[model samples]
Structures are given as structure tokens and as C-alpha cells.
Target chain A: MAFGKDHELHQRRFGRNLWVGACLLGFVAIVFGLTVVKVTRDGPIEGFDHTVRPQMTEGAK
Target chain B: MTDTSILPPQSGEAGFGDYFALLKPRVMSLVVFTALVGLLVAPVPVHPMVAFASVLFIAIGAGASGALNMWWDADIDQIMKRTKGRPVPSGRVTPGEALQIGMWLSCFAVVMLLLSANPVAAGLLAFTIFFYAVVYTMWLKRWTPQNIVIGGAAGAFPPMIGWAVATGGVSVESVLMFALIFMWTPPHFWALALFMKSDYADAGVPMLTVTHGRRETRRQILIYTLILVPVALGTGLTSIGGPLYMAVALVLNLAFLKGAVDIWRRKEEEAEADGYAVEKKVFRLSLYYLFLHFGALLAQAVLRVYGIGGW
Candidate 1:
């Protein structure tokens, strides 16, 4: 069986789709890496959640 | 299944490159480089990953504003020969698409920056987007000849944001870096206006060349260049500066001042006869002026790692 050739328009669409996929993957990887670094590194993570926590209030005491 | 052969060809459809072009990658590059220098030169150390992520977000923020600028300026862009072929003006992308992309990316970049870096950097990035897209593009650009002089602030903020990323606040060094770009902007742009002929005039944008005439623009270029010399040299005395930086600053400033004086001294008839050679030369040197200054700073930073960069 012979395969049909892809048109220029189809090729362009494919290229665009590929870039979009790559960008999404890259963004995900960057976010994951940032999260890992932030969590594993040493310092007080100042996340706010309405409820008072001991570590957050330690300076006041 | 539909036959592939039956699908209609859309010749005008925009591809990924067109969308990327909408982001003004060239401007984004300046943003990335300056911001990276800002991040590295700070006294406080940043994690490699955090620094990378923060700069990436800053570039994205700069790009988002670029897209928005293209969207707003599409009308004038179509008129200006230099910008007539941009994505929106060329009919490759819709204004609505550009707007949505810019808005979405603007939010994403700011929020991501906050998560990856600090609030100060993120806040500055948000403010930069607003300043470029709204204050400069919408308001100042059409209204005054001093548009670029003031709009230059938007471009100057990246380094400051980078410094804030590392230090979580601004300082003299960062402010000097900001001032360097801010002061450099007028002379750089005015030189281009001197050379580029009627593009700005035809576009209805009130460039100094259009509003104040070429002579005044040249005089203004000299004035700004004079003001720029002190700021450029002042940066070399800051904590980020070293003997190497000071030498580089002195040499570069002399060349820059000479270029500005050459531009100021030329008559309109002389420029028109020689295709604005002096103005073009100054424009070319201006590119190196910024790059070398930043490169010297980065070199000083690297040398500091080995115990001998700054005074």
C-alpha cells in the first residue's frame, strides 16, 4: 500500500501543533523543578492559609 | 472519515512562528539578558533553578507586553514601513487572539514569578506589563514626542526585577543599572530616528524627529548622552563594580560620547548626503554600548566568585 503525501498546509499545522505540545511540556517541567527546589531548600515557606501556625507566630512570642 | 485530499487549503493561516513573532522575541531577548545580569550580580545567592525560573517568567512577562503593544499599535504598525509586516498588521493573526494571548500570559508570568521568586519581583513585573501596554503604548506613544524617553522605563525594569529576585528588594546598584538603561534609551532611539527617515512621521507617532524636527532631536541625543556618561560611570563605583568594570566603562563612555557629539555636530544636509552615516554609526554603537556594559558587569560577577571582582 502506498502512503499519501502531506500537503504544505498539513505540514504547517503539524509543526504548529508540535511547538504547542513542546511548550506545554516545557512549562510543566519548569513548574515541577521550581516546586521541588522551593520545597527541598531551607527557609521558612510563608504560605498563608487563614489558620495560625506555631512556626509563623514564633517571632511574635 | 473525511478524505485528506478534500480538506481546503488555508494559505493565510498563521503558524507557530507567527504567534512567536507576536511575542517580539527580540525585545524579550534584551529582557532576559539584562534580567539575568541583574540576578547574578546581586550579593545574595540564588539557587540555580530558582534563578532560571524567575528569569524565564520575566521574559514571558516582557513578551506578553510586546504582544499587547503589537495589538494596540496594529493600526500605526500597518502604516510604519518598519512594522508593516508584523503578525497583526500583516493579517496573519487577529487582534483578539493577540489580546487574549497577551492577557493570559501576563497573568501567568506574574503569578509564576511570585511562586518561583518573591513578591517584589512579581509586583514589578506586573507593573511593567501595565506600564508598557497601557501607559506607553496607549497613552504616551500617540500623545507626545517624549514617548520613548518615558516608555524606556518599561524596558529598564527587567534588571531591577532581577535584582529584586535575588535580594527581595531594590538597592543603589540595581537603581544604577536601571538608570543606565533609562538614560541610554533616548540617545539610542533618537539616533535611529535620525537615520530611519519618515517611518515615524508617516506612522502618526509623535517621535522627536516628527515633533521637534531633526536638529532638536540631534541636540537632545547629545544632551541625554552627556547625562548618561555619569550614570554609566557611577555604576562602576557600586559594589558590583571592579577595576575591570571601571576600565570598560571609561572606554565605552568615551566612544559613546564621541558618537553622540558626531551626531549633534552634523548638519541635515550632510546627513542626507551620506545616508545618515554618523547617526547609523551611533545607532550601531549603542547596541554594543549596552551589551558591553552588561557583559563587563557579568565578568566582574564571575571574577567575584574567585575573590577579586569588586573594589
Candidate 2:
């Protein structure tokens, strides 16, 4: 909506828009990169254990 | 900055920081903190990366809602001194730009959240964005005196969203977290309404203080705060609760009740004479009240990590 306008606020917002978009994409990249690296057979990087089997309740079959 | 009172932003006036102002960073910070607490306190532990991603996207979703709120409320904002300096109202950013930012960010946050977390969590996040932007901002806000009461749901949904991100479904724990914010919202906002009387009146928003008299509003504040006490303390009885949380909740609720009582007993003339100092104090306490409650919840989670706290 503000593409054609050439005011200082508009220009400033446009510049910020680029930086914010870039930063968001960068964050996504970092997250996905970490996800892929952490999804290995060995398990996640921070030692988040997803390997525990659920213990059955008492009197189970 | 040159006055763009009748026109668009003046040339060479606003900076990049002005665009960030539209995000309502203060509100987003609260959402991030509470959502983090929710995720931390969940029964199911999540991957650290996933937890980070979920909180980040939820914060983005909050910012998106803020942008849209600024867009929709620009008119009322321009009328009220409290909001006159907002990006849209101040001519630092146009309404169209605000809408564009809001829509794009909302979609990005929801989609990224889906990628980072499960569908249930992402869906709730999407619904939260929609509720805050479309449901509350566009529909309910201008239409009813009960707006804050109902619209508070938009703010209340974060902890639920966080819990969903962790567990991939709703549960009583999550509902209680939602209830904590939902019930507290009325009194929290009504306190502000009591102090900032002219802002809503000038903006034509049907705040409790505007529709009902301040006496009734103060009475309602006491009533809601009375009700809010149990909900705050109720968390202590849940699995998330512990001795520390119970202790904190007990003292906070008593002090909060006293604050409400103090406000309830005051006459308008006395309030005006004191420059609404008591009202302002209560408003500040409300901020700390929520913050401390959530902080206690987070503390319980930390203790649980050491295998100590939580029943």
C-alpha cells in the first residue's frame, strides 16, 4: 500500500521491512538447520531425551 | 517530525524504529514470557529447539495482532491522547502499511509455527491471531461495552497455545492457565479505565468506566479481583503448583484484594484530589501480579527439573 509513496516514514518502514524479513528468514534457517542436525539417530543436540519408553501403570495386563 | 495531521508522513521524518513501535513490543514481551512459562510447566517435556521456535513464533503472532489493532483502531487512536503517538495514528506509518504488515506477519508466524511445532499448536496460534485481529479488533471492540471482557480471550490464549505446543492438545492445566489470564483481564483493564478515564471517553470506546459509572466500575473491579484471587491461587492446587507457588500466590492475592478494596472505597473527588495515585498504583500492581504469578509457575518448573517441586 505504501510502495509508491516516497515519504521518510514510508522509506524507513520499507528499509525496516527488508531487514525484519531477512532476520525472520535467518531465524527459520537456524531453526530448521538445528532441527535437521538434531534429528539424527543419536538424538537432539541439547540432550533432550525423546527415547524414554512410557512406564505402564500398576495392575496393567 | 513535521505534522502530517491532515496528510501522510512527511518526508525524512520517521525512522526504522517507528515501524517497530507498531508491534507493541511491551505486550509482545508479556506474551513471550507467559507462553514460555506455559511451555516450561507442561507435563510433556519438549525439545529445546522446538520450544525456542514455538515461543518465537507465538511472539510474532502477538506482534502481528498488535499491528492489525493499530490499523483498525487508528481512528480512535488519533482521537485519544493515549494512542495519538501510535505509528498509524501519528502518521509514522499508514493504515494500509499496518494492515499489510499484520497480514503478512500473521501468516508467516502461523506457518512457521506449524513447521516448528505440531498442527494443534499451530492451529491454536492461527486462531489466536484471528481472534485478536479480526474477532476482537474488527468485530467486538467497537460494538459492545463487554468488549474487554470478551476480547480478553485474545490475550488469554497464549498460555494455552504454549501448552498445546508442548502437549499437542488441550487439557485442564492449559484451560486453567487460560482462565488465569481471562478472569484477571477485567480487573486489570478496569483499573486502567478508572485512571485513564478520558482516553476511552474521547475515543468512544465503551470501556466499563465509560458505560457504567466509576463507582460501579470500581465495584466490578473488586468483584473481579475477588474472583481472580481463587483462580490465581487455584493454580497452586494443580500439578504445576508447589509450596513456593502457593506461598507467593497467597500473599499477592491478599495485597491485590487490599488494593481493590482501597479503590472500591474511594470517592471520585478524593481520587481526583490525589491525581488518581491509588488507581495508578493498582494498575502497576496488576502488572506485577500477573508477572509474579507466571514467574512462580516458571520457578516451579525449574524446581521440577531438579526433581524437587510439583506434586
Candidate 1 lDDT tens digits, A1-61: 9979998888999999999999999999998998888887976568889998887786875
Candidate 2: tens digits of C-alpha lDDT, residues B212-243: 88899999999989888988888899998999
> B36-120, model 1: which lDDT tens digit per residue?
9999999999999999999999999999999999888887787778887888877788777889999999999999999999999
Model 1 spans > 4 angstroms off = A1-7, A43-61, B1-11
**Candidate 1 — which pairs collide?**
none
CA lDDT, every prediction? 0.91, 0.85
In lDDT terms, which candidate is top?
1
Residue B84, model 1: Cα distance from true site in angstroms = 1.4
Worst 10 residues of 2 chain B by lDDT: B1-10
Pick the TM-score winner: 1
* Clashing pairs for predicted structure model 2, backbone only: none
